[model samples]
Target chain A: MKLKNEQEQKVKAGRYGKNFGGQYVPETLMTELEKVNKVFNELKDDAAFKAELHELLNNYANRPSLLYYAKNMTEDLGGAKIYLKREDLNHTGAHKINNVIGQVLLAKHLGKKRLICETGAGQHGVATATIATLMGMECEVFMGEEDTKRQRLNVYRMNLLGAKVKAVTTGSRVLKDAVNAALQDWASRSEDTFYVMGSAVGPAPFPEMVKHFQSVISKESKKQLQEQAGRLPDMVVACVGGGSNAIGSFAAYIQDPTVKLVGVEAAGKGVQTDKTAATIERGTVGIFHGMKSMFMQNEDGQINPVYSISAGLDYPGVGPEHAALAECNRAQYVGITDDEAVAAFDYIAKEEGIVAAIESCHAVAYVQKIAPTMAKDQIIICTLSGRGDKDVASIAKYKGVQIDE
Target chain B: MSNLAQIFKNQKVFIPFIVADDPDFETTVKNITALAKGGADIVELGIPFSDPVADGAVIQQADLRAFEAGVTTQTVFEIVAAARKETDVPLVFLTYLNIVFKYGYARFLKKCQQLGVSGLVIPDLPYENRDEIVPLAAKYDVDIIPLITPTSGQRIQKIAKAASGFIYVVSSVGITGERDSFFAGLSNLVAEIKEYTDVPTAIGFGIHTAQQAAEMAKIADGVIIGSAIVDIVAKEKTNAPQALEKYTQEICTALRTKVEQ
Candidate 1:
C-alpha cells in the first residue's frame, strides 16, 4: 500500500503547484525524459559538477555580471531608485549563456554526442552554438524562417560557430513552430542528442533545470543589491517570453513575501488588438508544446499565432512556473505595448548608455510607468537579460529607418 | 460485450487510421463507411491538432488540410456522429491531450460515450498521467488506450497491467512515420508485455505495405497503418474514400492470406 501511494505521488512529482507541467510527450520520449530527469536531479546538487560548471562560468562566460545603478533614469523618474541586473555584460551578451553552460555539461555527463536547440531572436541559438563549439559537441539549431530572415546575423554566427541552422517554415513560421520542429527532432534523436531548451517552457525538468542554471542571476543580483542598497529591493522586474530570465530573476526572492515579483509580457500593439503576445493577460489554461500552461489559444484549443515586435517575446505561452506563480498570486504579470517597449529601448540606451534587448525593454517600459509612482526610498531591480545589439536593425526598421542587411 | 472486446474475439485485427474532416465532413463519413467495407476491425479517427509533434510529415499535412478546410472540434464530433450512421466498427479517437483538456475531460468523455467512441489514443497521455483521465474515462465507459513504446523497458508491466481495450505498441524509436525498418527486439518486447495483461496489443508506426503488415502481424495481435493511408489521402485528395478503401482491402487481404498459411 505504501509503495502504491509512493508511485501515485511520483506521478505528480514533476508538476508545478496543481495544474501545470507534466511530461506530455510521446511514449518513446517519456522514458528518455525520465532518464534526463533522474540525471538532472543527481547532478544539480553534485559538488564536482558545481565546481566544473563554476569554472566554465567564471573563465569562459565571464560570470558575476554587473549590477549597475541606472542613476540617470533613476533621477529622471524622480521617484524610486532603479538598479539594473546587467546580464547584458555576459560573454555571449545575454543571460542565456548561464543556462546553456549548465545544460551542455549535463548533456556531456550523460554521454550525449549532439545538441539540439530552438531559437527565436537567436540569442539562445548563439549561446548554444558557442557552448557546443567550446565543448566539442555537434550542434544544430532550428529557427523559424521568418526569424531567420530578421535575425540573419545570428544565423551566420551559429554557422560560424560550426552549428547547422535549419529554417522551419511550419505553423505560423515563428518561435512556436521552431519549437515544434526542435521537439520533433528531439523526439526522433533522444538516443544520442540532448535538446537544450532556451527557455523555462516545455516539459518538466526543463522548467526546473533552466531555472536552476539561471538562479545564478538572482543569487548574484540579490547579494549585489544588499551590498549596494543594504536591503532586498521592494520589487523585482523582468521580461517574460518563455520566461527563463524572469524565473531566474525571481527564484532567490520567491520566499520573501515583502519582495514583489513582476513579469512584463510583450503586447505587440495592444492587448485589445488581435496582435499581441501577452499570454498571462489574455491566455486560457491549456496544454501545448509539451507543457500545460496559460496559452493564447482558441476556444477549440488550437494554439494562436501570436505577434510581438521583439521575436524573443513572441511565443503564445509563458513558462508553466510563471503560470502557477500568477495563479497562486506569488507574481503579478502585466503587458507592455510594442510602442512603449520601443520607446524605452531608445530611452535606456540614451540615458544609461546601455542598449537593452527589446525584450528586456518591456521591463524598462513597465518601470517607466510604476517607477515614477513609488517612494524614493523603495528600490526596483530590473533584469537587463540581453544586450540589444541583435535587435538594433529591427528596431530601426520598426521606427521606419532601414539599414542594409 | 463492448465493441473493443468484439474486435479481438477471434482473429488478428487490422486497424486503419485517418484524420477526420481532412477535406470535408460528408467525405469523412463516406471514408469511414468505405473503410468498414474494406475489412477494418477497428478505425482510429485522428482529431486533427495544429501541432502534431508526434507525427511525421504525412499526418501533419493531413492536419493542415483539415484546418485549411476549417475543421473544428465540433466538425470532428459531427463527422463521427455521421460515420456512426454508416458503420458500427469500434471508433477510437487519436487526439492530443490539450484538445480533450480544453473540451473538459468530463465533457469530452461524455461526448465520446454519446458518439460511440470506445477508446482514446492520446499519445501525450502516458500511464503516469493516466489517472487524471482514467477515472473519468471509466465513468463514461471509454477506454483511455495506453501506449507502450520500444523504450518502455520495465515500466511496460506497470502500464500494461492497467490497460483496457488494447495497448498501442509503438514499433519504432520516434514519432509516427513510414520506415523500412523497426526497432530491434520488438517481438521480445511484445512477448514481455503479454506476461502482465490480457489486453490485446497493436503494432503501429512504419508498417506501410501489405508485406510489412503480414510481417508485423506475425509478432502482435493487431497491426495499425496510418501514415501510408494519410499519404494516400494527400495524393488522391478528391478520391480519398475509394483510394483509402482499396488500400485498406490490400492490407486486410494480405493479413488473411498470411494467416491461412
Candidate 2:
C-alpha cells in the first residue's frame, strides 16, 4: 500500500527515509514483512500499548535519564563545557534495552509466538532475550561462533533467561555470519517468528522502528540539558558501531544544524591497517546486512573482516543513516586508535570513578582530545552508553596490564 | 558446426562445466587447456554472483573464496576472452540476471556474441522476463538454454518449446549439492522432458559420481556436473590441470561405457 502524502513525507524526511528503509530481502519473507508492518502500524495508535510502555519506562527503565553537567572535568582545561547523558543508568546497563523493550512489545502486539535476533557484542541479544522471557515469549539468538566464545558470559546470561543461542559458523564467523543465519532461520519460519533486528540497520521498518525506539534518548537528553543549563548543548558525541546510541541521542537534535554531532569509531592499530572498522574515515559505500552503508570491502563486493579490541565496534558496516549523515556533513566522525581508547579507559576509571565499556571509551577518548580546546561555556553532551563490565579483561590485555577492580 | 543443435545432432559431444574465475585465473586457463586435451566438445563456465540462492554450501564457499581472491564479472569475461585462443570448445557462459542487467542486456549479449560464446544458462530468467533478450539473442545466434525442473509441470513443455540448443532438467528440487544418487529419478525426468521437444536434454545440478554419470549417459545426451567438478578444481594444493583431466576422463569413460551398452 502507498503511504499517504503527509505520512510519506514525514517518514521520508527523517534521517534514513523510506528510500533507504524497507525490505530488500528474498521473496520468502515478503508476506511476513507485510504482516509485521501492518500489525506495527495498527498498534501505533493503541493507547494500551503506549500506556504499558510509559509505565515500564517510568518504573522499570528509569525514564528521562539525567544529563549531568561535568563541571569538574569541564573546568580542568576548559574549552567547551561537557555534559554527560547518563544512558548507562538505564535498566540492563545501556540504551540497548530501550530498543529491545519496544521491539519485544511489538512482537507481542503482532501475536508472534517466538522472537529471533543476531548480536555481536551480545549486549543487544541479552537485552532482547531478557525482554522476551519477561513477556513469556520464546526467544532464540544466532551469534557468531567466534563472538559466542569471546562473549561467553553474555551467552550464559541469555541462556539463563530461557533463550536458545545458536553459534553461526559461516563467512568470517562474525556479525555478518550471524545475520545470515538469522535471515535463513526467519525465512524458514516467518509465519510465527519475529526477527528482532538489534541495531538501526537491516531492511525497512527495522531501521525506522529501531530509530524510533532509540529516539527517546535524544528527546530526554534535550529536555534534561535544557533544564540544567537553560540552553541546548552545542554538540553531542557518541560511539558508532551499528550507530544506535549515536542515532538515538542525536535524532531529536538533528534538525538543529548548529548542534555538532560527532561519532567516534574504534580505529584499531590505525586507519591504514586492516584492523580498523571506522566506516566514515576508512570505508566506502556498499550494501551489507540489507542496508546501503559504508563498508570495509574489497572490489569483489565481499566484506573484509574487521578487527577491534572492542567486539562491539568490530563490524564491517555502519548504519545507513550514519552514512547519509556523513555524506551531508551533519555529523563529523573521528577515529580513535586502540592505544588511545585504552588510555581513555584508564583515565575515565581513575578520574570519573566510572568504569565504561571499551566501546564507550572511544567517545570518552574523543572528548579528552577536543575538550581542552573549546570555550568554557560551550556545552557538549557525551552519551555514556554502557558500563565497562564486559570489557574489563580485554582492556587489561590491551594495556599489558591487569586490573583487580 | 554452425549451431549447438547442428553440432550435437552429428557428433557425440562433451560439455565441461568450469566456474568463471575458478581456482584463480592462471589455473582456470590451465584447466581449460586440460579440458581441451581431454577432448571436451563444449565448455559451460559459470560466473559467481553475491546471492547465488540456487547454489548449496560448497559452491557458495567456492564463490566466496574466489571473490575474496579478486575474481569479478569483468574478470570472468577476461578469462573467457583469454581462453578462446586455447580451445575450440563452444563456450557456454552461465550467469545470473544481475550480471547482464549490470552490463546492460543488449551490450552483454553483443559482447558474448563478439567473444564467440555459444550459449547461456540464466536459471532464474523465466519466460515472462525473456521477451526483451530472446529476440536479440536469436539475432546474434546465441542459444538461450532454459531449464525444466522436476517441479515444472506443463511449464516443461513451454520451456522446451521456448528453449534452443539443449534443455536442462534439474535432477532435484534443491540447488547444486553433491549426493550419492546424483542421477536418482534423472532417467524418468529426462524421458518426461524428451516427449515435449526434440531438443537434446542435458541433466545438471548433481551428476557428480562416475556411476551416476554413466547411468545418466545411458538415457540423456549430455551430463553437466558443476559444483563437484568446481570443488575438485578449486582445492588450493592440487594441480588443477591434473584434477580436471582425471575427473573428465572418469566421466567420459563412464559415458562411453553407457554408450557401448
Question: Positional deviation of B178 in candidate 1, in angstroms?
Answer: 1.6
The sequence of per-residue lDDT tens digits that candidate 2 reaches over residues B1-261 is 127776567534567777777658877777877877776667888887665545667777777766776788788888878888887667788876555655667878888888888788876465544674788888887888877765555556666777788877667655677776543566777787787778887777766787877766676787788877787876742487887887788777777766776
| Stretches of candidate 1 exceeding 4 Å from the true structure | A1-12
Q: Over the stretch A1-405, how does candidate 2's per-residue lDDT look in tens digits? A: 222332345364232523333344443444466576667677756899878877777788887787877776677646888888887787777788888888888888778899999988888888888888888889999999998877777889899989999998777777777877787677656667899988888766677778778999999888888787888888899998888998998899887868999999989989789888887798875545555567786655546788887777888778877877777677899999888988888887887777887888899899998988788778889998887777776666665787653
Chain A only: TM-score per candidate: 0.97, 0.93
What TM-score does prediction 1 earn? 0.97
Off by over 4 Å in 2: A1-23, A402-405, B1-18, B26-56, B64-74, B83-261
Candidate with top lDDT is 1
Clashing pairs in 2: A22-A204, A79-A374, A79-A375, A80-A374, A356-A388
Best candidate (score: DockQ): 1
How does residue A14 of candidate 2 score in lDDT? 30
